[model samples]
Target: MKAVVMRNQTLVVEQLTAPQPAHGQVLVKTLACGICGSDLHMYHHCENVLSGFRNANIPVAFDPRQGLVMGHEYCAEILDHGPDCDKKLKVGTRVCALPFVISPTRFEHIGFSTPYPGGYGEQMVLAEPMLVAVPGDLPAPIAALTEPLTVAVHAVNRAQLSGEEVPLVIGCGPIGLAVIAALKARGVGPVIAADFSPARRALAEKFGADQVVDPAVNSPYASWLQVAAPSDYDMRSPLALLGLGRQPRPCVVFECVGVPGMIQQMIQHAPPRSRLIVVGMCMQSDQIEPLMALPKELNVHFTFGYTAEEFVHTLHALADGSLDAAAMITGTVGLDGVADAFTQLARPEQHAKVMIVHD
Candidate 1:
């Protein structure tokens, strides 16, 4: 199989052995895959790449330095099933499988310890019960967004924002924008999105963000707070009062920036009795003040990836057009173009979601 192989940070289109389904795995034909921010981290060594190795939960067995088929956000068609696979799945069926196949109970679980021989090639193997059937109406390119969209949905769900609580997402990357879209579909209260990128802010508007804030051009907390009603502006600090609209106060803050100090800033800016959801993967050496949690009476919710049910919800939202995954696709590249895509993604402020289309 032809794949975009990365060896010692050098990416080349090379032929590699296709992965076979293990005892409980399924072989899936790679349809479409989305390049995530984390992939760029590994590809570029992002000033703190070693942390990714330590963060991965699987046993230390594979060496990413030698080369790994790196890509996780994808939708595939089942081509074969392992001997122990369930009979529910059929060949040619479209499905969005969980890229993270980690289970403390399973003996051969492929934890994030090593890159999970992801969907960057023509075919790969995925664990059973991890792949969810995508609706027919959801195109493969759009369904490819299931994993990233699920990340956003999981963060919002963790933040505890419902119909009664307004959400304030503190970034406008693909994941942050997905949070805005998911919040609208779930009938959650008004949402405000913050980002410094003009392109992403515009995309946020398309995804139903009531208002967009460019933190560099405008003070996100200030601009958002002024429009917030007094109840929404309950941050208790006069300095935090900034928005000009009469919107509800933000009861939940989704800090998607994953920057070193952004979480602390959100906790300080957020109102009392609010929860902050950490969705972004930041550099490992970034220092944070842990004591603020007690003084501010803050609740921090750390969430990663998605559960089976949320992945299904993500697929449903995409199939029904509740979330525009197609629009999130800022660029698409072929196997040979993986290196350039990584370069562009490194400056994500310049691009949204970049898709890797298997030819």
Candidate 2:
């Protein structure tokens, strides 16, 4: 099989042995796959990512210095099942799965670990238990978004919002936009999104953000205060704490930007009692003042991947048209064009979520 392998921080097309399904696994043909932000991080800062994994005691099966086939957000067609498989879906059924293979010894992240090639290649093996059928006639490119959108779904789930807390999304990247979409799907109120990129702000509006903010001009928190904070509510006045006036509706801020100093900035600017959910993957060492969050009494929650139930819910929502994310697919390319697509994705104004379509 021909795959775009990451070798020495450069991607090159190479012929590699096609992976076979192990016991309780299924082999699937890659129909479409989305290039993830993590993929770019691995491409640029391989050693840092590896070091973090090592320090965390996360064992990776492959050596980054040699070669890695990186991709996880994908839509695929089932080709065959391995020994001990039930074969419930049948051959040629379209499917998507959580990108991991559960071995008897340990969990292998499908894209990052060794032995199991990810969706970047023509074919890859998936743990049968992790597979989810792509419902209805959803196109492969759109269905491929199940993985990334699930991240947003899990973040919203972790928030445990009262439906009254105004949502202020701090970044309008793919993850931020997905959060906005999930909030809207759940009928959560007038969503506010902030980003420095005008293009992203526009995309946020498209994804159902009631208001968009360009941090270069106006503060997103100010916009939230206008909608959520009562006119008489004053954090500075001691009298205001007695419930004498209408209290401000709490704001649930989603920090989708992983860059350094963002969490501190949120602590400084966010409304008191705000719930901060950090969804971004910051690779480098970051610093934050713990004392700043003390006064606000903010509830900071750091989120990672989704639960199996949340993943299924995300797929069904996308299939039923409850989650309209068609606008997120900004571009498509063949495997040969993946290298160039990565370059194009660096420009936020030009694209959001580029898909690699396999033929």
Candidate 3:
């Protein structure tokens, strides 16, 4: 199998032994996989991710010294089934999965498991129990988004949002765009979004943000001032500079920008008693003063991964055409180009949802 792997804190493309599925598993050929932000975190912060895995009680430590294949957002096809594997998916059946593989002894994440490999490889081995078969007509790249879409879906769920709440989202990356789309699909929008990229701002509107702000041009909080007039901004505060003082601000804010001060910024300007959902994956430790949020009594919510039900719900939504992910894909690359793809994405919004084609 040809795979893109992390070697010595760098990503390299190589040919590795294809994994064989054990009983209740199946061999799958990768059709398409999306390079996830988490993969980048794993690439640069290998030790931190290993610490997380250890805390999560993963029996097998991630031995970066041995190399690791990384990708969870993918679409695949069953090549062969192992003994006693469920035959519901015949060979060539197109599918997506929850990015988990359950071995007899323990459960492990697909992309992180060297033993099972991942969708970044030309071939992967997946647990049959986690597979979700999609219609043959669903595009591979779009199908590959099921994992991330579910992630956003679960984020929306965490909010327990009503169509009435005014939601402000920070960032226009794939997850940010997905959150916007999910908000629109659930009739929750005319939403506000902020990012540093003009390209991503345009993409955010296409995904259903009624308004978009470029923080690079000005603090995104500037635009929110009109809706949320806390007090006299004195022209210096981010909330006051945008000529604010309309009505009060929104009740909820989605912090999708994964940077050091995003959490603090969201906390600093959030309306009293508002809910702040932290959806971004910030890799490093930070010094955030709890006192900032304490006075406002803001509800801080942190989330990770989706339920199996949410996974299936996302697949069904994509397959049935309820979730139009055609706009989510920004680029395509083969295994050899994956490392570069990661580098490109690391820039301030160079692209969104770059798909890795196994073929």
| Best of the candidates, lDDT | 2
Deviation (Å) of 184 in candidate 1: 1.0
Estimate, for each residue in 25-134, the C-alpha lDDT of model 3 and write its tens digit: 88999999998888888888889868866776755356788889888898999999999986888999988887776656877788887676777889988888888998
Local accuracy of candidate 2 as per-residue lDDT tens digits, 1-359: 88899998899988999998889999999999999999998889888888998897877657987799999999999999999999998999999999987766888998897788887899999999999999989999999999999999999999998898899999998999999999999999789999999899899999999999998898888888888887766755554334446678878999998999989888888866789999988999888887878866789999998899999989998999999898998999988999999998889998889999999
Per-residue lDDT value at 158 in model 2: 97
Worst 10 residues of 3 by lDDT: 234-243
- Measured by TM-score, the strongest candidate is 2
Q: Where does candidate 1 stray beyond 4 Å? A: 46-61, 102-116, 231-250, 290-293
Write candidate 1's Cα lDDT for 207-325 as tens digits.
88988887878767666556654654445554434433443455678888777888879776666556788888775656667665666567888888777888887788788777665
Candidate 2 regions off by >4 Å?
A: 59-61, 236-245
Q: For residue 159, what is the lDDT in candidate 1?
A: 74
Off by over 4 Å in 3: 55-60, 103-105, 228-250
Q: Model 2: how far is 314 from its true place, Å? A: 0.9
Q: How much lDDT does each candidate structure score?
A: 0.75, 0.89, 0.82
The per-prediction tally of clashing pairs is 12, 0, 1
The lDDT of model 1 is: 0.75
